[model samples]
Target: MHPKLVEFLAGCRDEAPLQLGVLPFGMICGIASLAAGMPAWLAQLASAIVFSGAAQLVIVQMLAVGSGAAPIGLTAGLLGVRHVLYSVSLADYVRHLPRRWRLLLAYLLTDEAYAIAILRYQAQTAAVHQSVPGTPPGNTAPGATGDAEGSPVRDLRHWYFFGCGLTLWLTWQVSTAIGIVFGATIPADWDIDFAVPLTFIALLTLLIRERANQAAAAVAALGALLLAALPYNLGLVGAIILGLMAGALSTRLARRTRLAREASQ
Candidate 1:
């Protein structure tokens, strides 16, 4: 088989395990959308329109409560702003691609795809650096014009990304469809809704590996508790902003402290 197809299949294969968590997560969203009184067609349409599980839940919750559009817009923007950061972090690896390639890959990008694709790209960088003659151990600054761009591995890497993303997208769509069709028949006592928070809590545990993340999460929880009475779900918005600021501030402080220790030594 061609290398491009190989890479593509590699991405799909790697993303398979993560779909275990995703299946139930998507089902919860579909069931919630229906419970919120959305039409079946509209609820399924939302899986495509607002792809993020968290964002969809927030939007559907607001709609269920009869909130105004202004708050919904703000909340959605905040959720999407994280994607900009994800794209920027991955931009250096994809810089040489045509605009069409970049745009299509950008749509496929997601939290799971990104986590897998980045590690693959980094491993490529390391592999090339080691295999090439006279390359420095630390010289991984391989942009479009660099040594990595000329290699076959570089050519096929994006296909892997596409594969991973497309698989998740397909799984999400199918899971949502199943939930929508059999939602009413499912027993109420199954307590499947508990999976909603459990899934995110598992994800949150993976993310909070440092003081900065801990700080951000703590502030966000406190902010939400304090501002819970705010109308139009503005309290959640404030909590998000405060959490971001706290994380940023903590990161800067940690960097400065490390720099100071190095200077003294």
Candidate 2:
């Protein structure tokens, strides 16, 4: 096998465990999509096209409730705002790739894929930085360009990202197909919709390692609750915007504090 293929397979292996969590969410999304009176084909198509569990769930819920197109579009768009951050974080790692490759990877990018890819990128970056004699610890900058040149690991990072994304894409499509086919058989009392929020909660738990993230999340939750009565579910959009602002502010404050401490020292 080519070295890239080997690295890709390794990436797939690394991502396999996370797919267990993703599978049920994809299935639940399909179930909800169909339950909302959407055709089975469209449900599966949305999985293939949108490829976003949270956004898909929002689309289904809005459709089920007979929401207007503007609200549904706004809700889904708001739910997907996080992907912009993911793309920004991933840009440095993938910037060397061709435009077509970058576009395809962008399409394949998801919460699970981004999480795994970032960890791999950071690990490889740290390894490279440590192997060099002059590099200090904790100095692995996001846009470190030297990591990619003549570095097999850097070359493989894209393949690894592709492998993780492909595995997730396949898992989502297959699980969604099964759900679409068997949706009618599911018990109405089961309330499989709970899986959507649970999946997000699990993702959030993994992501909120920093104090700024926690603060932003708390503020966002409060904002959402306070604005819950807004018409056409616009509160969802408001909460998302408020969350971004809060997170950005918290991060800025933390950075400034760290800089001040460094100056004092």
Candidate 3:
């Protein structure tokens, strides 16, 4: 077996649950799109090509509500803004590669893929930094050079990321096809509505592990509820923007406060 395959398998074992969780949601998006009267092929294509769960759900929901294509396009655009950030972050690691390779990397840069890649990248980076002189013990700066023996390990991380992306892509395609085929057979009263809220609540709870993130989440929730009446689902857009701004501002403030305390000491 290739060294990277072993590392990829190890990393994937730890991510099994999250991988399963994402599949059902992606399938649900497919079912929802079909239920919303989307063409079967369209739903399947969206799941195959777009591969973003939240954005796909939002698009299908809008379509179900008789919303215009423009709004759906806009929603997808707004949700996809996160990809730009991911690309920039990943650039530091793969920037030296050929432009053709970069294009392939960009296509595979979904949320799950990015998470796995970034974690492996950070781990390799920290290992490298630890080997360097004058660097902190735990600093994980990208581009930090690992020892000669560690080069194989670092090289292996890329294959790990590729495997993760490929696995997710296959799962998404299979689950989506199933959803499109059997969506109408599922009953509406199956009590699946709770899943969405529960998933988000779980996500929110995780994000609230820090005081600043907690405060920002609270503020954003309020802003979203207050603006919930906006038409064309612009309220959703407003809520996201407000929430992001609140989180950013609060996090900056918290950092400043911490710095001030250190200075005072």
Candidate 4:
């Protein structure tokens, strides 16, 4: 098999397990769309464009209550503001790709995709860092970014990202269709709501092993509690901003502390 294909397959394989959480989220979006009086076709189309489960859910609820276009647009845009940060962080990894490829990958980039893909991209950077300890970031690390002397991982990373994104995309579409058709028939006793948090908590715990992550998580939690009264789900958006800021600050502080220790030595 081609190495790129292998990387793609590995991404698909790794992402498959996480669909346990994604499937229900998609289904609920479909179900809720139906309950909100959205025609099946439009609901499915909305699913394709919106893509993000939480954002889709908020949009559906807004549509249900007859919210105006402006508020809905503002709310959805705010909800997705975090993706800008995700893209900025990921730009270093994919900057060398052609524009078409970058656009396609950005479309595929979601919270789930970002969570999984960023880890893989960072691992590639770490490999380079280990190979040349003390090399600075940015231009120095473009090797994983397809410089003439780029690492194989950098050259083939898009394949893995494509694999992960494609799998999630397909799974979501299929699950949405199922919900549109049979969502009303699902038993309430099944209590699928628990899976929502359970799945994310698992993802969260896995990512929160570091102090920076823990600090960020704590601040986000506190922000959510304090800001829960905000309208149009602004609380959630505020919490995300708080979390990202906390994480970035903590990461910078840790790096500075490490450099200071090394300088002292």
Q: Candidate 1's residue-wise lDDT over 81-127, tens digit each?
A: 76886798788677767999999898888888887777777666778
lDDT of each: 0.79, 0.79, 0.69, 0.83
lDDT of 2 by residue, 1-265 (tens): 7767876897799889777677778878888888899888888889999998878887888888888989788778877887898998787777778999999999999988887778767666678676775554233333232344665323546777889999999999998997888867878797765665665676677777788878878888888899999855567668877887999999999999999999999
TM-scores for every candidate against the unseen true structure: 0.76, 0.81, 0.75, 0.89
Q: The CA-based lDDT of model 4 is what?
A: 0.83
Ranking by TM-score: 4, 2, 1, 3
In candidate 2, list every pair of residues with a backbone clash: none
Q: Report the C-alpha lDDT of model 4 over 1-265, residue by residue, as the tens digit.
A: 7767887897899888889988887898899999999999998998888788888888888988999999998899889898898899888767878999999988888877777877777776777689888653333342233536655434667778888899999989989998999999999898776777777786787678899999999999999999999876889999999998999999999999999999999
RMSD of each: 4.4, 4.1, 4.1, 3.2
In lDDT terms, how accurate is model 2? Answer: 0.79
What count of clashes does model 4 give?
Answer: 0
Candidate 1 regions exceeding 4 Å error are 122-155, 201-239
What are the per-residue Cα lDDT tens digits for candidate 3 across 102-212? 776677677667766676676667676677756542243432335766452233355555666777777778878877887667687875445555645644654466676
Which residue pairs overlap in candidate 3's backbone? none
Model 3 lDDT on a 0 to 1 scale: 0.69
TM-score of candidate 3 against the unseen true structure: 0.75
